[model samples]
Target: TLFVPEGIDDPEIEPGYVERAFATASRMTPFWTEKSRQAHDIQVRSGTFAVTMDGAPIFGPLPGVPGLFVNIGYDGHGVMCSIEGARRLADLMAGDAEHDPKDPFAAERFLDGSNPIPEPMTIHQVQ
Candidate 1:
């Protein structure tokens, strides 16, 4: 989802506060562009970044929760990793895989005050 914030000024966006985050994000950057003046999405603050704890996503049927499943905390690569997440979930449900991939994203890692994830460029190289 797009997840734009309040004070967005794009002509497509009405002049008001964006209360629903998911809806706003849905309308954000339908595609990429190099020019800000031509952008339809509004910028809240520049040079901002998101932090996800160091972990893989929590995918597949959750442990000890009968029939319950989850696919969350995908970090910034959700778009790139969604297929993997779906495959993993499917495998677990179909009895093809033995366990969740890792511990960092186990849904319980954030319980004990771990460091927040850093921004994309700061965390890893793209090319």
Candidate 2:
């Protein structure tokens, strides 16, 4: 997926984005063929991106709100981390695992002023 790094405040889709997307999709894609699909063809989808303050995904419960859990703040790793995140959250809910508040992905880390969670490598590729 291509990341543009912009807020949703402006709801308009730019023509440049469409062009770039079409260009990227047409490059060496096995499923795309001359008879099946055109290189310039593209469909616009509505969606938004979410990112936490420290650029790490948040997992576990919402502090001070018992029984109300959350598995959000994925930013862009939802596709990659969905299964594991779901499993971990489920384990916590089922009492099979424990939640470490100091962990980078912990949902309670945002509320802890004394402890700051470092940004995980998911935010950038190590070059």
* Top-TM-score candidate index: 2
Clashing pairs in 2: none
Candidate 2 lDDT, 2-64, residue by residue in tens: 466654554667668765554566576745344235544555655657777776677788788
TM-score of 1: 0.45
Local accuracy of candidate 1 as per-residue lDDT tens digits, 12-115: 44335343443465468633223433546665432323335563566655666778878876656677887888887788778887664355455555556766
Task: Please give the TM-score that candidate 2 achieves against the real structure.
Answer: 0.66
TM-score of each: 0.45, 0.66
State each model's CA lDDT, in order. Answer: 0.57, 0.71
Off by over 4 Å in 2: 1-10, 22-37, 113-127
* Residue 40 miss distance in model 1 (angstroms): 8.1
Error of 2 at 24 (Å): 5.9
> Which run of 10 residues does model 1 get worst, by summed lDDT?
30-39
